[model samples]
Target: MKRIYKISVAIVTLLAGCSKSGLLDKDTKDSIDAQKFFNTATDLQVYTNGFYEMLPTYTLYTDEDSKSDNLIPLSVDARVKGARIVPPTNASTKWVWDDLRSINFFLENYQKCTDDAAKLKYGGIARFFRAYFYYEKVKTYGDVPFYNKVLSANDPDLYKGRDSRKLVMDSVLADINYAVANIPKEVKLNEITKYTALLLKARICLFEGTFRKYHSLGDHEKFLTEAAAAANELIASNAYKLFTTGGAATAYRELFARNDQDATETILARDYNTTYGRQSVGYLMTAPTAGVYGIPKDMIDSYLMKDGTRFTDQPGYQTKGFYDEMQNRDPRLTQTTAGPDFSVYKETTREPVNLSITTSGYRVIKGLPSRDQWGSLNSYNDIVIYRFAEALLVLAEAKAELGTLTQTDLDNSINKLRARAGMPNLNLAAANASPDPYLEYWYPNVDQGLNKGVILEIRRERRIELFNEGIRWDDLMRWKEGKKLEKPMVGMYFPGLGAFDFNNDGKTDVFLRTDNTTPAPAGTTSIINVNQKRLTNSTSGNFNPMYSTPCTFDEKKDYYYPVPTEDITLNPNLAQSPNW
Candidate 1:
């Protein structure tokens, strides 16, 4: 357990605030120093509060999904390209452990507090964050060294090798379990509670369980049971439920933009204040006008029809144009994208489809606020980190994977989410009878023989419900479906180079051409954009912006990120990840 004291001291002091004016004024009765800072309950709280910044904010949360199949970037990342050669000196390499030391320092020092209740409560907080830190590290680089306590500069344990995944995850489970049992039960806006710990435990356990099950690591059932039990505990608490106080179509969007004090669905959120300029670029980046990040046609095709039928099952589904295809689909589709009669600020209705705003025809509308509330600094809607819907998905998937699922369980978990969206309940018997063709194609790993149909449907529900919330990359990695990257990234469909009406509003929206010399149809109102290198094929008869070359993913190496080369050099005992 080697620790870098320079980084550790700066982080601990800034977070713990030992030298800050009034941080120690409450306990002037005792001497204030680095080692003596943990003498009071207030000290324990301030130290633990420092860890909240470790959680992902709104921008960071949504940006993560760009790496997955759900959202396509203006340009593909180097990590997602065909030949991902991550060097040892790559600046983006996530092969460090400063967060671990911050957490371990608290665990080692919180016990020094004389108050029993304060010690237990704050100790639980420390353990919970420790679990979070390690889970992220393991998810990024598998089998990292585990350290439970802060170490000195010359500690020999710092030279130790990587620990097994099982050993590290078991310790994570222990930490989360302690936090779940000892943490307070009060409902909070953004504070950790027993419910928070339970939801995280469910999330982490499900990830490990599915990873092991898919990668053939064994003992998957044990982790699945843990996931199920943790989710069940949170569900039984009766403190949270789906946000359904408004129309089903608008309910999902309102959940993200609402600033109400009572948010029933959200378990934990990263709050922001517009006046303080603590906002995210949710509107500017994801809006149809920005064009930086856009949702793909593959994700749009995944949504079920309003009647809960597969859209791909319809004849000529692939050939259907954008406006007609969006009709009678899931309500979430309309809410998520700029559909017909699209409006900002809920005032005027107009169809605005700017090709420059989105690479795919469909732009992101998930976190966009009203026109008056829309700005880089004024978008203060709280970003939800965890909510009850994830708990429902986790519970249902865990049970299905464990082969212990039933109609009653589906009714309790998946059915609740469906009802919120005004979609029909999923029938276990019908699902097991025949899995959807689209799902079977996308999630090829589910083809393995073990409750295939229900498992696939559960996965579908998870994707549809939690698409832009930034969990897709982890979901794909854990399920061993990274090969999805190889699929062609296509956008709005077109017959060929022609002026087409995307919104079907009796007006031309986009004018396609093989070259700038190609004239637009005489006097069309469509926006004339020249096609040079913008699309994969200027004359390929379809709209694919990123079709320069087909993408490829190496399953053997892409699953786990490479351990930084510099880190391996520093510690000769450390082994590089496979295929690095």
Candidate 2:
């Protein structure tokens, strides 16, 4: 609940432009305005069409996982490592009101249509976006001002202070509930529907519920119950399902790379086409040698064995080699990262010997494109935003945290995901008897109770299922587990930098020596630029690829961002978040 930044324009003076510069007004006769825009359902549709553009796509390649343990970038971010500073103004801040303004504009004008059904339908769409807009705001800054009306620059409400998070979330709940009731029941891959609204509602509720509970803010059950109810509604409807078009190993991989999104699982996705101006750089950004992206050794170790047993439980598990470590693990492990016999972009003929691309030796294969679609900065594959898999995880976690989860709940929610991954069902009693040490260390604040084991499992499932999808940072933040950032950002272990065959292709594919003048040894395909890449004790044996640098996480000051000084100066009613 930080007052992060001030709006550039003071609300009272926003509409003071003179007509000489056409600043006060342009010709509304030809241009779309509030009165002219919502006259017909077609007009309403066209106006709402802009809202879909606001939906996230992989094109915005700010992979937040880079800020967490899920993946490591070329360099550790100073901000994530307790080096952030408050900016002078809102200019450099991510906190923006334009998206809210757009949604509020539509909501204020969508009722011009006389047809009751059309009005309700379009209004549902507007409300859904409003809810989404506020959800992002509340999550990012907490206790943001809520507005249903499209405020003019001169509107008094523009200068109002921040509202309580509870009030804003209640408003969001109302909007989403209306959307679920009135949005069309018919499902579409790229468009929002009643089910999409339900999914968003569930996600929002689970986040707020968990956040309040972990932060010790009371009345958390209200949001937990809402989250559970929304997820249960979707489950009962049977309108959506986890995409299992192929076998377990390949199904998960295919879900991200398919030309079209799998309608069974994906409720709404941001679409792209070669001809369309909108294209995604996700593939290129994550491609080999594109950026120094790699998963941490800790994350790699979290994947369970094929039979749903913890890999860490295996004898000598920590000492296993790269290829050996990947064997017979969760099918998703092989799907998400390159494993033995892995090929480039699903092309069996193309061998994955590009060791230069992966810092951890665990190359990322999720969402990469085939040879045909592998242009430098082009990929038309849709980025899924809302999906049934996430809803299932939300249901399981929320129920577990509420302490009301039953074996039946596990059978319904977590079991389905495990089944899709070709793993066994989780046994509550067994998991408690031997909680995974890796997860317990990551979430050390959690109390050992009846729900502890199930909660840990749910967290693992959420991370593995949603890895690289931009959910980790928010999950950590809401759980008040930011201290995990201070943990070492370690990658695949190596005895020493030397020439070795990475893919076991019977050819030495990597020459990892530190000497720049040393030409790659015979048949080497990758070179480690020690000066450029991170490595723990680069000069010594037994090094980590990702933990070469030092970083820290300030438990108190780093949790919520601070409000800008200018904003607080402008409005004394505004207060900074705790400790900042």
Best by TM-score: 1
Model 2, which residues run further than 4 Å from truth? Answer: 1-33, 60-62, 278-289, 517-521, 529-534, 539-549
Off by over 4 Å in 1: 1-32, 89-91, 259-261, 286-291, 372-374, 515-530, 533-541
lDDT of 1 by residue, 1-580 (tens): 1110112334464433322111111221222365767889988877777777678876654577777787777777655566666566635666656556667767767778899998888899889998998899899889988888655546777767889999999999999999998998977867888899999999999999999999899999999999999999999999998888677878887777665425498888877664434464555554444436768787888889999899989998877877789899888887777776566535566745665666766777776666655555667666788899999999999999888999999999999998888899999988988888788888898735557888888998898899789899899899998888887777766656667776675766677765566666554544534364244445534457676656788887888888766667767888988878
Error of 1 at 249 (Å): 1.5
Q: TM-score, each model?
A: 0.91, 0.90
lDDT of each: 0.76, 0.74
The deviation in Å at residue 152 for candidate 1 is 0.6
